[model samples]
Target: MSEWDSGKNDGKPGWNDQPAAVADASEGKQSRQDRKLIDKLVMSMQVEQRRSRRWGIFFKFLTFAYLFGIVLLFKFPLGQGLESATGGMHTAVIGVDGPIAADELASADNIVSSLRAAFKEPDAAAVILRINSPGGSPVQSGYVYDEIKRLRAEHPDKKVYAVISDIGASGAYYIASAADEIYANRASLVGSIGVVAGGFGFTEVMGKLGVERRLYTAGESKGFLDPFSAEKPEEVAFWQSVLENTHGQFIAAVQEGRGDRLADDPRVFSGLIWSGEQALELGLIDGLGSASYVARQIVGHESLVDYSRTRSPLRNLVDQLGVSVGHGVAQYVSEQRLELR
Candidate 1:
């Protein structure tokens, strides 16, 4: 055999045998590299899976917390927890707080309901309307006034008294006039017997801004007292006449309620506010006292039970949201609003 074909030459491997060993070593190294790559891939996948699980758990916990908060809001309300503990003879107190609008806390519906409840209760000695407002809608005040009169006629034994706290004026006083006797603190503001309507004229502003008002109305007076349009003398006069007529009605109602108790001063019905002491002098208020004082002294009952009808928690929440959105919309669309205040 030749030296090249022999397995050994000079006790060392031949070139052909060296090539075979090198191929085997290269194959083994490639196998080890492939195994390391697979292990790294497996470890990377495990780490990603662990991170995803943690994030999923965190999101699930947050969702649970959000649901729990919603439940609590629905369960508890803001300010409505009045219990009628009329074990014996007690005085019924109905709160006429805030504006006296149809949708307000002192609405005619709420006040009438409270009045009826107080009058119907056998343990209630008398009904006291605890008022603290700057006044609002005349229609709402009129409704409450008429109801108080009717209830007073029905329940002749149980008297109805009005006790003004901080301030009671205009429509507030209108309702108070129907009471059997009215009372207020010495510094309380009382009486504003008049009607008013006001709005800003934006015609000049529109002219400066090069804005055109496109108003469509079928009737002649459909767009009466529009803020965007120019004011007409006849329309202004007509609006004034309407206000005077409403004022006349307000005066008549006050006269009928107060009778001879009112003073001869013309300023009493001139939309002027007066202190409780001045109101007493002008016959606007019968006495000077608080709800507690009237309850203990006039009604002869020390125990006072709230008979005010409060809005439900769900209704309050809905109203709050609605008012927030509606208020902005109202300001943008119509800045002019007719109110007693």
Candidate 2:
């Protein structure tokens, strides 16, 4: 029998030796399949290696960029850099804007620091307080006024002027009065020589809503000014006297600052705001002009340098974060109370 037919025919090939050609063809097919599988695995491994390398490079660059940004933010003294950049013979301006309060931009601490820095500059011809504020916080205004006077006395050579932009009233006017000369635009509103405290009475509304205000205090007058409590005539009179005394102090400071320049009008210190022309006529302001006009015409220097202090970005971020967290906690508590109800 032929070698191929010598195999068992039990529905399968025999275990004996097969034909050489058939065996050779089967081995070639199996070798080709093995080669294809190996090639696919190698290709997959190459692709994976390339992807891993690309991701590794991306992460390295990202980490480097983040670190560089941190270095610039924390390691650099940006304030000093700004001061140095303003080098030259120029008029240094410290802005007194917004509500002059402890936490505001126009706070006493910020104004005084800016003034000190401006005055320390050798090339600064004069220091100008560029004011545009409705005013706030008597204590803050007083602190700024005292600092200006002290600085003026300390550096008589460096003249300090006040240039009113739009409005300089109450506490703002108080600060302006300490200047060597007060200038303003013809249309600018100037002067509000007074002290004030404001609040709203919510006792009647709370009573209508059936909301009881449970307040306890050791002193009888401790919670006297609470909006939910009824106004007492005695408390009212005492608060009025306090306001009047504060107003008196304000009038005295204005008089001392303006000296004989103020007019003999009784309404001048009656918390009245006047136009720049009227202010000049009343001697509340020295002249009708702007900062640019004063810098060019009065101080004889056109170059103006701002010495305004600002909170750092990081500090501002931290403050905002804290505020956000507090707000979130308060909101959560409010939601919990609503859920309970």
Which candidate's TM-score is highest? 1
> Residue-wise lDDT of candidate 2 within 106-145, one digit each (tens)?
8888899899998888899998899999988788888999
lDDT of 1 at 48: 100
Query: Which lDDT tens digits does candidate 1 get at residues 1-341?
Result: 77767866787787669889999999999999999999999999999999999999999998986676567566753233356664788999999998888767789988888888889989999999999988888899999999999999998999999999999998998999899999999999999888877788999999999999999999999989788999999999998898888888889989998999999999999999999999999999999999999999888998999988776565556567685577657754753555564
What root-mean-square deviation over C-alphas does model 2 reach?
8.5
Instruction: Report the Cα lDDT for residue 35, model 2.
Output: 100
RMSD of each: 5.6, 8.5
Candidate 2 residue 105 C-alpha distance from true site, Å: 1.1
TM-score of every candidate: 0.77, 0.71
Q: What lDDT score is found at residue 75 in candidate 1?
A: 71
